[model samples]
Target: MAGTAPGAITVALVDDYDVVVVGVATMLEPYRDRVVVAELDTNEPVKDVVDIALYDSFAQPESDHHEVKTLIDNPHARRVVMYTANFHPDLVAMAQDLGVDGYLSKALNARELVEALESVHAGERVISTPPSKTFANSGDWPGRSEGLTHRESEILALITQGKSNAEVVALTYLKPNTVKSYIRGLYRKIDVESRTQAVLWGVRHGFLPDHRRIDHWRGGP
Candidate 1:
């Protein structure tokens, strides 16, 4: 459902950790109509050459000149943005010195993130998140049921993406039992005893069944 507008920004979420990559991809799913989150990365140049490439620092530990330079050299990523959790001033400056178009932290919420990307797309240098928050965290998403909790909505979102319990654990970075427990609670709250039923409910409420989104890390060139 990525955008088709002629001026729509094409971007790639590049991270070594598959789970981080998937998590970011999931976070951006609702904005498909505004930006094209291109499926990229391969031996060949990525098919949908992107306007920006968001390099998650979890995948890249260091902000060295050569590291940023390599990303800048990627043909598919015309502009490089160090999308990371690290905000140490020295590291940020080092990255910027290496021609990174934007140095964005993972602390920004989804709305702030899209705004930063849009600003970057418009040729602006965005380097800070809103003053209030210092880390990326999920919202208290209310579910369709009156008693459903935020964690339930989170689990429901993952389930609707066609993720198995194991995949959900990987994406959420949660323990196996913890994920199962959340699933069990969500199942009860959603009034669904089976995965299929839960998925159906999610679909009815606007969550698309994504059988292949799990492979988004491998989707690039």
Candidate 2:
């Protein structure tokens, strides 16, 4: 987390959405002098001494599963945030059990994302949620999906559509806060740490169309 002074914290963004990557990078640009985003992938490997490894929990879970485990296992990668959209309660619990720094949803706003990244990088956990007034019912997501609930599937679907947390909030008509909770749940069930992975996982698992055709945030084509 807070290894040194307020200087560039190495960040790795692992999502499949060019829009998300571009949006996140733009928001982080102001802190470029203090924060450096190394590589952006749907998988892992921005091999340097990275303080924060931010990735999509939904990204190719099978393929990146071992890679993510390896990344988290590395002591050098001190901070880990599972940024994702589609997941189940069990997945979020797993992330907590794994002791990841935090979880983020692409559906979250730029401000929320920056706060989460900064907080995680500083050794704090940032949980993103929409306005409290958005939803009237809060289901016990923990037990909703015996294996993979309908809501979990919906969250994943929105992620593949390139919708931000805010966008998903508006689309689902659920309270922004509820959507955020859904994202958290998804991470635990899928055993991932970020949204980039979520999108990738969707593609790999046939939930989302393969978007490798899009450009990556770190100059990927």
Candidate 3:
């Protein structure tokens, strides 16, 4: 569950296996009064009041894409737990990037799954592996250059919105080559390697306005 309020949370389980479904239902029997398993299939829309959701990684790619889209689109779908038989490192990283609350191996017993749910409900990230240690010791880099020109800042803002080079050029009315030059300058000013990383840093340091506010970029006549 995502929220701390016991009465506020509704859980959904989306999986293809009946055995797995039975195991999860058995584990959640204690909280059956509070937790409602909507269904075993991914055909239905995830309810807004649902604070937590679980998905079987073995689900078809189309189902997985839709599930991720649903969770990302729904602001209320804050915590998601993905259970899979395959614990491949790349798959785990992909799950983390999608902002899942927990990634547990399906081979684990119901007790472990229950514990993961409990921890995730408590607002803790319940993933099985530890987060990267490099970030644990890394200090914030003094990378921002106050001397960035206005146009450079504008380019950075567009990049943060995840606009591609061609899109940025169209948005700014700049030539493609000019856009690439601006991006190079942005990377140097921000001390980043790629446009995506530069954009992330810009957003993190408040150099870029919230991407949702892009309409503000078009000035009134």
Candidate 4:
């Protein structure tokens, strides 16, 4: 691997939603001098060599999944960082055991986020302080325009992927009743009376994961 430009750590922002990664890229814009965002990938592999591959867990699997391992195994990514709101003790321990360089909280401000990346790049393990409540919704997701919260949209996305409520509970670590509540709320927002209808609505909308990459050097996609 090649060294990054002096005084700037090359980074790749990875997520399943364009708006999610784009939002993170926009947040890091001011610190371009310290952190050069080389790529914004949506459900795609990182194509460029970078100091850090910041995997944003936005409506995607948590850090314990194979996705994190994929990033870690990529030769182009010098280090892998999990940028997620899920800070359960088991999840944190699992990420650390999986050899992630950093486990960051989405509640971090831009400056804090940059500093954590820098620390990881400098050969130190880092983890941010977990938020008291759920992390605030910062970026976009499917059904946001239809009054669905991020969590609800996440549930609907899983449903659109053909995951049953039990599977959703397993994947999301949400209580069974909580999952049901989200499904009910999601159905109400989309005006669907049945799961099949909700799935159809999600399919018509943008619940599916995207497959594209945005290169910052040549300008974003």
The list of candidate 1 runs beyond 4 A from truth reads 1-6, 41-45, 129-221
Which sequence of candidate numbers ranks them by TM-score, best first? 4, 1, 2, 3
Judging by TM-score, tell me the better candidate of 1 and 2. 1
Off by over 4 Å in 3: 1-9, 16-23, 30-44, 62-66, 129-221
TM-score of every candidate: 0.57, 0.49, 0.46, 0.84
Q: Could you tell me the lDDT of residue 65 within candidate 3?
A: 44
Instruction: Give me the candidate number with maximum lDDT.
Output: 4
Ranking by lDDT: 4, 1, 2, 3
Whole-model lDDT for model 4 versus the true structure? 0.78
Give me the displacement of residue 217 in model 2, in angstroms: 18
Q: Per-residue alpha-carbon lDDT of model 2 for 1-221, expressed as tens digits? A: 34533566787655544544454567666667667666544553333567787765432341224445655776646787776553445556666666778866656655566667878887787655523332112211222333445456557767866778887765444578898898888777877789998877665554553454213323335
Report the lDDT tens digits of candidate 4 across residue range 140-193: 567777888878888898899898998888777778999999999888889999
Best by TM-score: 4
TM-score, model 2 to reference: 0.49
Overall lDDT per candidate, in order of appearance? 0.65, 0.58, 0.55, 0.78
Model 3 steric clash pairs = none
Query: Model 1, range 58-172, lDDT digits (tens) per residue?
Result: 4233534455566677675778887765565677778777878898866678877888899988889888752445343632232533465544555676677687887766554
* Candidate 3 global CA lDDT score: 0.55
